[model samples]
Target chain A: MDPSEVDVPPLKDLTIDNITDNVKLINSQCPDPRLKYLLERLVQHVHDFARETRLSHNEWLAAIQFLTAVGQICTDVRQEFILLSDILGLSLLVDSIDHPKPADSTEGTVLGPFHTHDAHSEPNGTQIAHDPDGEPCLVLCTIKDRSGKPVSDVKIDIWETDSKGKYDVQYEGREQPDQRAVMHSDEEGKFWFKAIVPVPYPIPHDGPVGKLLKLLKRHCYRPSHMHFMFEKEGFDHLITALYLRGDPYETSDAVFGVKESLLIDLGTVNAEQAKTYGVKEGTKTIVYDFVLVSEEDSRKLREAKAMAAMKHLGLRMKLYNGLPVPEID
Target chain B: MDPSEVDVPPLKDLTIDNITDNVKLINSQCPDPRLKYLLERLVQHVHDFARETRLSHNEWLAAIQFLTAVGQICTDVRQEFILLSDILGLSLLVDSIDHPKPADSTEGTVLGPFHTHDAHSEPNGTQIAHDPDGEPCLVLCTIKDRSGKPVSDVKIDIWETDSKGKYDVQYEGREQPDQRAVMHSDEEGKFWFKAIVPVPYPIPHDGPVGKLLKLLKRHCYRPSHMHFMFEKEGFDHLITALYLRGDPYETSDAVFGVKESLLIDLGTVNAEQAKTYGVKEGTKTIVYDFVLVSEEDSRKLREAKAMAAMKHLGLRMKLYNGLPVPEID
Candidate 1:
């Protein structure tokens, strides 16, 4: 239909008082209902943010320039936008909201920018460290269902930075898939791999996200931890990390990915204990167990979590009923 | 101080319950107190927006991708980010906040992307329309101060689209400028020029902003209006528009630029009146008077406005004492 032929609603003068209505009118023509809703909510938030801050035109222009720089800096190998989200603590917040685990199941964290599909599958207990300049470490883990039954034949993807606190991808001329491997749980739901102990590392700070962090006077380091992703046929996929206990950054992870339950002790092993894992003396060992929720249980948990969030938000809205709330038809 | 040498505060795991604290920690290092405050406020609003919408990871990714595209599409002549801001009503909001007018002074609208500094100066009453296909229009205006005193020798930069509803820049292989000129008010603060009545025009929508507008199902037409920028020493610069009263999009400008006070009547002129202005009969004529504010008065108004905003925001914060309020120090 011709928009001009139909009676279009009069556009309100763009003022702080009518910003919400103007946004709604502009978005009224959205063909997709979901997109319309999202746009409407986004518009209201953006307008409110400006009003709350009494944002200046210069500040608005600065934001535009910063975002433009972020886009210009992005390439196939780099995603500055995602990095911005990570540093803003948004990545972790989205992860928590999307992956609400049952009491017995492993809690999820951010699927950081480093994970890749090209990681080669390696046998259980295979050595993952290539240039072993750091302390030798052995990682052992098991996967079990919420009912306490061993979940065999599960894929576990493990990755971490090298001893010097640099991912292989960060090197200029490094080979693909360094310090990363995909391992499957054996018949007993057991998996193990050899690698250097992970260390706190700064995220790539040479780009716009890094510049923003510096301007904000915030550090750019993620805590010492090993990223893990577990998947099986009838269970919810879990992406998590095992943060090393006592690591300085463990308490202040830049991405806010750490959880108390996810922290594990990194114990020093004697020669005899090291020999059992076919490693030299003074090697470090970390053992962790992950519980997976069944798909049905996960769905139920998500529903309950969403309902709770709605109730919570509803209560909060009552406290500020005078504030404009976007109509969501 | 070396961040590594000094004992740093422990990082808290990112959670909904601790989002406010996490934001504070991230901004702890900001050297500029004002920037620190802005960042903290920005972080709170962003997190709250996500929670209010229950924004999903997929939705967040989509936003990241969209912003990246907007940045990527920008060039020397094209600014997709600004267009996005205009469509979302942010440009107008920012303009309104920054250019608050007194009761007697003219109000400002959006400084659209089409504005250029390359317009050449012409004598008062000079005809701006080089090619005469459009209906002839005669613009007559006078400039005065808030005290009703004539303010002469002011530079009046005027621009509008032609009969075909396209700017010179929009036409491929066109001249440097068309239908745009800078005129000086006479000793009596009177100015007049000859041009065509501007027709409604669409904003450049072939780019990312246009694509977004299409997705949102909103039309992209701006109402017929003539842009004016008045400048003189010791006076606050005025940027405004004289919108035609009966234009179809006058009530619903795509950029939300229309104000009732800015609208002017376009009346038909008789042969005798046309001869007086040295124009043909049946020409359209528009007469308007603009009021300027002194720079000192503008400064005082801004100070008062800022103080009022601070007081208002303080009161609002009291209503949400339970919510996270960024620490000022």
Candidate 2:
């Protein structure tokens, strides 16, 4: 507190004139041996990015607001951020990194924003086409091995909407289970079902994700398709989607779900041929089978293993995505 | 764009599953090879911090909104986020990193959130005491080198307010200049001023930063003090703030601007000493002169730099206490 002590200047002076100094300053906040190196790097890139863009203050504010709205739109039954990721191609990128296909194998496309995992398994020859208004068409298909030989006893779980493009869970006035089904293929590696070829339609668009799409001048429609899971022993079990042909939205499918290998021919059957399947003449039928790669050896974030490892790791668990998950310690 | 070529998957995939992954992903984006390593490291630490906290969606959303508001409040006239950095002790950390103070030297504190580049420079023998009710004071001190040699031609830039604890810009109706001084010390390396002892006061609140302080359960008062800048060649130029002795906010000052070396002694200068400075006899007065070290090179954001670079780097050109400007390429 002495006045005399103030007159003598000390060493270590800093001259700040530009943005690069920020990079250096952030570099100095190193603490924990593990994080020191990381902080130093991020500060540099963040500063560099900001400098390179000359990003205005208002633009930065808008970005923050957009992220805030993205968070506000997330809910128990809806994942608009995930939908955003799907539309922006980030989700597809992640799935792509984890799933690589060999030549002549099933090509994985974008999985639309909605997915349910508790589908009940049905035995072979079960009819899942509950919608009477749908085109009564008999679908015939065979599950084959990579070498093209038929593989019997393959499980084929299928689900699709009715001709009006309304899934069962979506429309309440429709008959119970009218637009959805779960069925398995026969032991002879064949599956037949009676359903209509679904038409492409727009996703629900009253939300922020929808608003963002409109802002980006993009559409909200996805090509109509059916979902399937086909699996057998010693072959890759595939969970895939098969799209119907002659849909105009196929080329510009908003969810980016259209893939060439998944498109099925929806040709009409004659009255004589349709009579064999107990349907009227010129009755158009729709059918498709899914192909999946065996993921038996893929890395899975299983709860059992995670719990066992949590003790020594000092891990803390939180509820996320409706699961008790251990975050990184 | 052809309808027939619709089913296509993207070429590459990326996911930020962990801090290490984030480091790797962000590092690859840095254009400058020199900065790549640093940015990679920073992203790792920031991501690790997020991971370590297991920050919730709501909390992250709050943080994003806070930052957005901070940015939004920042106009060309006022940058609230920078002020936030100053008040939160981050500005000091940045100063520490950029300056690299030697151990046992004076501890550097933050350049408090309000400094105007256009602070009117005062000449020797000019009185800035505009408030008639203030405690009259005479400040006198000599600038010296580390070896105690008196430094000549030392430039002293000083600024403070009247005893009522209000700055000119803060009081809209007063119509008086709370900031009124542009003076340097004499050839004896001595500087002196006569004014009322400034009183401690709360910083201007009512802004969003003030609201955030309330949310964090912190206060907004700053202990009374005067700002000083002293400089000469080859010595460390300093921008030091001195706190008033026995001020109420001393120990628990909100912004953590208290430094032992920066505290001034309130020794009573009798009537005889007061007469020498042209102040009324026995009138209360306080005095302290600050010394500064020589500055090295200063850095600035490159003008016409890439748009992205300007975003983050532009924050540096903001508050120049005292330093040489660096090249902008």
Chain A TM-score by candidate, in order: 0.89, 0.65
Q: Alpha carbon lDDT of residue B198, candidate 2?
A: 67
State which docking tier applies to candidate 1.
acceptable
Q: Put down candidate 1 lDDT per residue, A231-279, tens digits, no spaces.
A: 8877887889989878877776767788989999887768876777888
- Specify the CAPRI tier of model 2: incorrect
Write model 1 residue lDDT over B1-329, tens digit each, in one string: 22463344666656766766766766767876556656777788778776665566677878888888888888655678888888888888887776678979888888777777788899987888776778888888899999999999999889898888887777777658778999898988899999888788888888778888777767888889989998999887778998988898887777888988898889877888788888878778988999999978875675566556667777332111112223445
Worst 10 residues of 1 chain A by lDDT: A316-325
What is the lDDT for B68 in model 1? 83
State, as a TM-score between 0 and 1, how close model 2 is to the true structure: 0.49
Question: Model 1: runs farther than 4 Å from truth?
Answer: A5-7, A25-34, A121-136, A153-157, A162-164, A168-175, A267-283, A315-328, B1-9, B117-136, B152-157, B162-187, B190-195, B231-233, B267-281, B316-328
